[model samples]
Target: MSLDDKPDNTAKPHDRLAEALASDMAAVDALIAERMASENAPRIPEVTAHLVGAGGKRLRPMLTVAAARLCGYEGSLHHNLAAAVEFIHTATLLHDDVVDESKQRRGRPTANLLWDNKSSVLVGDYLFARSFQLMTDTDNLRVLSILSNASAVITEGEVLQLSAAEDLNTTEDTYYKVVRGKTAALFSAATEAGAVLAGAPEDQIAALHDYGESLGIAFQVVDDLLDYLSDAETMGKNVGDDFRERKLTLPLIKALAKADADARAFWTRTIDKGDQREGDLEHAMELLHATGALEETRAAALEWADRGRERLKVLPESELRQMLDDLADYVVARLR
Candidate 1:
């Protein structure tokens, strides 16, 4: 079944997703707290906690725990690994806010907002170090390799995005390459580490990695879509933020793919150079609608989610495994 097949909670269907997550995420909390407590510098602890406690879906660590359960893991190392995954995810968000000059996250003031940029940068480094230490403590070379390589790819992806911004020449291939590196890399690493920790068979491990990678790409695609379709109150950020920042995301990329001469002039003047003005956003939206680019972007996310669910078929039937599939769907269902 597809991840989109999740039970609708309020209408005629009841979902037991929370019950499945509760089975494993309680220990994940302690692990996260323990990892966050080691900021030896007094300022370090407070600042990191602000970002750490900002609250997210905890999807990466959840992937670790879910993969472990699907693989029949019964040991406690999943706890430490889960924390490691969380630390990495939080560190990225901390650094991302700084890079994006973002003042808010998860509907609250960002660490970079509450504290100075320097504090956010240093605390992010601290979290990175702590993640490395925790992963090393597990003494699993494969796990370390997976996370470390993903880190490298994530940095490369960020750099790629930096370079791609405002470049109207960016293609769908380039967009996928960037997202795969920035987002999918981490998801793959988390699930692969979970399976490796559990001693899952090689094929199953590969399948889990594919599952996470697909889910991650699908999740990011939907996020990019929401920027155009939702309000800041619901999306937890400003609409047209990407356009303001001159960041070329999937919708923009698709719109660019079909830009006519006049539309091209509009984009090159406003979007590429960040020379936004009255009616610029609306005009851009018109181009995207006319070209059907928004629909195409959403379709791409749906295709990735379908691939993710298909990969899950490699795993045996179980509630936890089924929940993972549903969670994948939930990530992209926002687009629909």
Candidate 2:
């Protein structure tokens, strides 16, 4: 379904931004469709279309377009950049589902589940290749550099997460680094590359980069928090999937910090040891709340969101800027 399919009463800041950039988004969509097609390997488009056609918020691509428009760009090159951002995002999602052995994404069965791991991985590689081609179409080396660096960082972050997984001693510092790599890299690259394409002033570009980075960090923290607090109906995945998967997130990290002797054993059994039993999730939730980790995680999300909003003050005040600021607020407001 398209962004317009959402109810008017439910219109969020992202919906407002999508409406404002409908024409450019349409162009990006066209480019994406044209690039995803492959005659030699029909499964590339099949796998990609399965995920791309799913009702995602399409937030990353929209960010590229919005950043360009906010910087007074009148060219059509932003559409290519927007499409490139989306391809990179979609590629990552495809590979992530494979790595996580996920069954669902965006409220539907994952591409890997529908097809196979081999198809998902190869198709993701194809999309990455397509993204590079699109980025080079602008003939701007700086744009290429920004996007390429993001791709590398995203890969590094995933590997870092794998090493850090199930480790109770995982620090908040490492958590932030992982979040920046896995989530914020593409976000910052999207906005920064767009500004570079628009020939925006260096200061404005840096501000947009910081804004996107902060926004992405807040967005991921909220996501990790929601995995525990939200249910499958709202979150699409089973509640406490991260706990079951033995992943170390901010809430768990904070709780680990405050764990007493008894709590430490519980964490060791379920998180570090990965020997989760029935009712362990409920007890884990209790510990998280009792230790104030959930509240602390929520506070961190809000702080990052506020930092993102503050960064926007450097840019010219416009409807797009206000919507971007509100978007930052909205990411954390989901906790309410």
Candidate 3:
């Protein structure tokens, strides 16, 4: 389930960055769970922690930590903020898996698959509440505003996606709208909040925010591309899962536009009606290739990643700055 078989280019850079930023020695992990855990509700606490304990990239929270330090944040409260960001991300995954009826995530059984959907939903709610509490503890009005606004945007994005499902008319604009809501909003919040916590200058904070938004969009574009390119072992899920679920992600949407009458009719039948068979995946892959849909999508990701790198120039030269640039490149490089 390794996302990359190319020896993980990010490992050395990530380790170096971690050593440099250097959060609390033992307390960050503890604080992550402690902050996510619910009180006066034993079941909720344990269940919420179970999902938080589930392994992930920890990318969003790490951005928060990095932003805080790059901005010269000297306070310990940034860790709490990082934990809150992680909880929000984990909660979204729990809800997303349920909504998608997905059984696997990050190379393992999804929470909804291992447990019941009921537990997954309830635990997700508990985590969201806990995340809000953690944010409230930060006592920074701007921090609360950032996370809260992002949460609202995320929900709106999900709702739009739900409506867009099985609709063949989904456009590239629609795809960008979905990515902005479902992916970029949180990334922007995580990084922007970090800068805010550090009390960085307005221009610097805005640069990080833009950097995160572009990087997030790039990350999602690669994800959509991988849905067609990779198998379950590499991608952590079956190829064409989004197609089987009738999700109107970028790959499918782009293919729809380029489809000829015959191909368009096929799309209507399979994508719009959810009538698919074993060969359907292969056929759709062919359409994606012949129509140049995959390449078009990959180009969009590359453009965003490049813009993200450009945004990093706003930061002063340092090891942290270089790592952030590399991180942006990594998000979109999976396509290559």
Candidate 4:
């Protein structure tokens, strides 16, 4: 199924935006298809098509289009800009699956698993190059700079995540740093680039950037929470994947912060030592509850969602703005 075909509540905030932006989204899709094509290397398009065809909300690109429209832009360049944002996002996903050794993505086998790691990496590189080309086509220096810096920050975040992996000493501050670099940077850049493309005022651009940042952070936190609480059908991957992977997500970090001696030992054996076994995941969940980490994490997500909503106040009061306002709550609605 395509992004629009994914079964979801039509009344949901994102769905509303999707319906409103249908024409623009189609144009963006056409741009994506045109740019991802390769006559020299067939494998580049093949691997890219595999993942791009897989269902996703296309939320990052949508944010770009939405930002531009909200800024009163009536031009077609936002389509190229949105497509560039998607290429950046898709490139990261391809690289991430390899780094995580993930077998599944968007409820299907990952590009790496279906083909090979080398193909995935090289194709991802091709996509990155394509994204740069798309950005350059806009001829907006500020937009180009914002997107390029976001790409660098994303890479830096992934490296930081690798360095911090399995270390029980990872703090909440480090967790935010990782989230901002790996996830929020693209989100903020997507919106900021759109606003820049539309020649939006500086204050409005800053507000959109802040809104995207908070929304992205909240989205990541909730995703981590769902790794423990959601089913495979809901999450597209098995529950407790992060626990099995020994990744120090927000919930785990919060749990570790309040760990007692025995709890610390359990974490050490299961996480630090990478000696996870059956029942360990369940015990980890129990510890999360015992430490109130899950609750704390939930509250944090809500707070970020609220912050994102607040940032939208600076934008004009329109249907798109209301959808964005509602989207902040909708992002965390699953927790409810």
Worst 10 residues of 1 by lDDT: 10-19
Better of 3 and 4 by TM-score: 4
Over 47-157, each residue of candidate 2 has an lDDT whose tens digit, in order, gives 888988995888999999989888888989899999899999999999999999989888789988999999999999999999999999988999999999999999999
| Candidate 4 TM-score, C-alpha based | 0.96
- In candidate 3, what residue range of length 10 has the lowest lDDT sum? 1-10
Estimate the lDDT of model 1.
0.84
Error of 1 at 145 (Å): 0.6
Instruction: Name the lDDT value of residue 5 in candidate 3.
Output: 23
In model 2, state the lDDT of residue 130: 94
On lDDT, the leading prediction is: 4
Please give, for residues 1-336, the per-residue lDDT of candidate 1 as tens digits.
223344444421113454455646778887777767753578887886776676676778878878987898888888788888888888888899899898888888888888889988888898888889888988898899999999999988988988888898988888888999889999999999999999999999999999999999998899898888888778877788787778789999998888889999999999777788999988888898899999999999999999999999999997667677777777776777
The full ranking of all candidates by lDDT, starting with the best, is 4, 2, 1, 3
Root-mean-square deviation per candidate: 3.5, 2.9, 4.2, 3.2
lDDT tens digits, residues 238-280, model 4?
Answer: 8898988889999999999999999999999999999988889
In candidate 2, residue 237 scores what lDDT? 76
Report the CA-based lDDT of candidate 2 relative to the real structure.
Answer: 0.91
